[model samples]
Target: MSQLLDVIVAEDNIVQSAYLARLIENLGYRALTVEDGKAALDLVQDSGAQILISDYQMPYLNGVELTQAIRDLDLDHYVHVILITGMDEDEIRSNALAAGADDFLPKGHNPTALKARLRAATRLVQHSKQLAEQHRILKEANDRINDDLNAAANAQRQLLPDIHTEVLGTQIASAFVPSAVVSGDMFGCFPLTDTLIGFYAVDVSGHGIHASLLSVAIGHLITPDFFARVVLKGQEQPAPANLARDLNARFSRSENDDYFTMFCGVLNSQTGRLDFCQAAYPSPVYIGPHGNAQTVGDGGFPIGMFPDLTYENDHMTFDKGGLLVLCSDAAHEAENTQNQAFGSERLEKVIKTSHRIETDGIPEKIVEALSVWRDRIPLEDDLTVVAFRRT
Candidate 1:
């Protein structure tokens, strides 16, 4: 196809239309001449023609009428319309534009002015086409990412326990809510042996897919069988401190440098004694029969920071009728509409008020209180909470 024929010249006078066609050819574009606007519009529809050069007065449809018809045609490609007319009043130009003409030119075109206008029109057509292609590519990419996130979210949900359950001698209750499609927070409880129950919570360093994947990877790697592996190696079961250091050495990297903050604990079912380690995670809260909530452990460095860093284990007892709560940082960092951190203080208060509720309802109650304090504010981070009471 000749680049020149992308244009159609329409005029009621055959001589004028013929002259315009030749001028378009001289300008290096292929052109077609029609003696009226109606015929010119037909050519545009048939040829996917992009440019219309039509006189304001024609036997059938006039220039403005043709421009409006083209606009209403719903063609995939945009058409650029330039009206030619004897009138030069501002009102006429305004009406022509309102009628859908892209631009207007006085009849009997001067070579220099016509050349600049036509070239500019050509540039705009090309630019619009380019923008349309970019939009298409962007939509395709967005759809794929959304689909991937949906699948990842489902897999992440599968790695968690029921909303409430019992593990050995402890009544365990939990909640998990991701701020987005996937969460960086994870927690679990499993029987390490006939007398040992293991519990852990970790928040991988950030939100979304990368952090969620790392969090889930850690979850899968640590389990009841994991403790059994330590015994298979002919070594005593490691303390929570030893486990944290071991994980740090495995996950630490010089590039991208993925890491997490963690809390790990093992409960002796027979004695109701808890040995736990903290790695810069939020302190777990203890609520006993006295109806008060107190923090359990001192904070330490985050895991996977210094590969060889040593960790400290904290000791606590969860007698029957007592609640031990471990949560991701999101629990304390939740903000209210007043722009205040949900803070350790607020969490402690919530625990004390709800400690009298059933163990299974405690985490849910905290979530409900947080929802009210935010006053319609959306969660700004992934939220996870785990609590257990010796029965």
Candidate 2:
């Protein structure tokens, strides 16, 4: 029911202090009255007054001095100071305002004018306090949201595999850069045996946390137990072809209509036998040791697009020192500022001209080429690439 602020009235004259106190109380505010400027300053500091009404001439400290003392407290509380003055000099009024006084009340104002000034001051303080409170709440909420995002990003980073693994005489290297805090593109490798390695690169239909979560689900499914069942064919030994089919069937039955394009492969390091399959994904290029590049095709409709579609297994026997490069649509579909795509043809040219695939520079080259082609145009999709060499 109280709409008025906590006000401090500082006046050496008892009559003026009493008069202002009556006005303040009538206006529904609690006024703390002090006879001298020193006492007023002390009370304001102790009570945290939001408004100050002070006589211009007072013993010990004048209104200007009192205002300066209050400001020196340096508290967060906003104290709106009103100087009461009989002086008609413009210079005096300017000095009062420059000393941190918010307004001036002429000492001999009519009751109506005094009431009007107090009413206006009440509104101003209320509006300012409301704005300050809103700012505090907004800042707190923003901090909380930022903290949550950082926590989620750290968790996602932990989900990624450590980029080092060795099987037989084979060494693998991989890298991932999410377009956002998370991404839809995923890559992983698992050692199926001392001489065999299972690996996959997948790009789900969308991006962001939802797509990243789906990739996590796929990661969980790539375990030894799940792949064992997926690779199983009849009572006989499960082949790579059977693994591709089973994975597609499981994905079709369990997933939604939005398809995920992927290249899954199993490699036998001892014999240079690599059996792999693709589902509506880009064909992987085999870069032979002789510096020849050929696109290996194992095409099928992307899993989850068709329930009963069959995936074909493609086999490649690479010579020692050959390399394989697999990538997502982002690699080929990258566009320039003129809206021209950096198509698959450009990719092949880069690979061919380079003679030898520079182990460390492959990813950097792909990204650098794409960036140069973009020419400052914004990308609409995530770019991903993986390359491995058989030494």
Candidate 3:
């Protein structure tokens, strides 16, 4: 950035050295002279000089040797070396270049040629320093972005419910595996009153920061507190179907193009009765005291698709000791090494075989099964699972 300010000259002959140093000073640069190659290296090392001009055939250490040694040192600046030799320019050209000289000069006190070479070296130094500064600025920006993403992921964790817990005689367990720093899939159930519990499992359409942000916004929008605030003034409580319709209306008014699929439900804590609506989500598997697991509910329109989409509610009895399983598409869509999908049939098979495990182990078993199928962790999409058993 600043002009090539400091230069060091190594010449064993005092007469030629003084003449050359005078010429450099006339070019508006500070120049210092050393009588040998060893002194040149030391001066350049300590002074942080960016330009070097040296004479060949010096005693103890030659000019070529000095050039190589200076280049090898790990310094904060880049050095440009010029080799001045008594031999013909063609004769010493190969060896001088091989030893790392950037340009070569013929031996003598020619003021015009000296001025031209030093001028070129000044431009080279300016360009190199500019590039180094740009690299430093870009690295700082990347580090700041990574720090912000990590902070967002930590805040998103608060939207999730406790992992393995039981309340109102119901055991609930969940597992969340995000492929990126944040996740687009969110699921949790909250109590609406002493006699009722509402739950939802949702997946936004796209992946990454925008999708993750919307999922968190949607989580708060549907919570019992927010839902209670938006419902009709006279209505003390709302059914699951009416709640789904309200979400459709609110999201339709939003300017975002992204949409989502969800399963919204309510349970009578005392009677094991579930009233739920499935909006373009997976048909949750019902595991009761039966011999085989049965899938429940049919698909309907997804949320935010239509302003007047009337949602349908289905009823099922989550009898005591019965379990319900819900998951995002990432589970079945995961691909094995052979490129085959671990589809719905495989997921159903795992539920039937492992449903008898302790209440807290159900979600863990599903995650393990998925890991084995994929042969590793970190699936390509956000993976989420929620399982609850009525006791």
Instruction: Give the Cα error of residue 1 in candidate 3, in Å.
Output: 5.8
On TM-score, the stronger of 1 and 3 is 3
Q: Candidate 3 residues 65-105, lDDT tens each?
A: 88788878867778999989765656576777887889877
Error of 1 at 369 (Å): 3.6
Which consecutive 10 residues in model 1 have the weakest lDDT in total? 229-238
Cα lDDT listed for each candidate: 0.82, 0.74, 0.83
| Model 1 lDDT per residue over 1-391, tens place | 2344378888878788777777788888878778877898899899877888888888788788888888889888888999986655677677789988987778777766667778988888888878889988999999999999999898888888777999886899999989899999988788888888887889988888889989999888887687445422353543777678778878875456688999888888878888888998889889986766789898888887766788887777777788888778887888887788889888888888888889999988888888888885768889898879888
TM-score of 2: 0.68
Q: Report how far off residue 118 is in candidate 1 (Å).
A: 3.8
Instruction: Return the clash pairs for model 3, or none.
Output: none
The clash number for model 2 is 0
> Which of 1 and 2 is ahead in lDDT?
1
Q: Find the 10 residues in a row with the least total lDDT in model 2.
A: 232-241
Candidate 3 achieves a global lDDT of: 0.83
Q: Highest TM-score: which candidate? A: 3
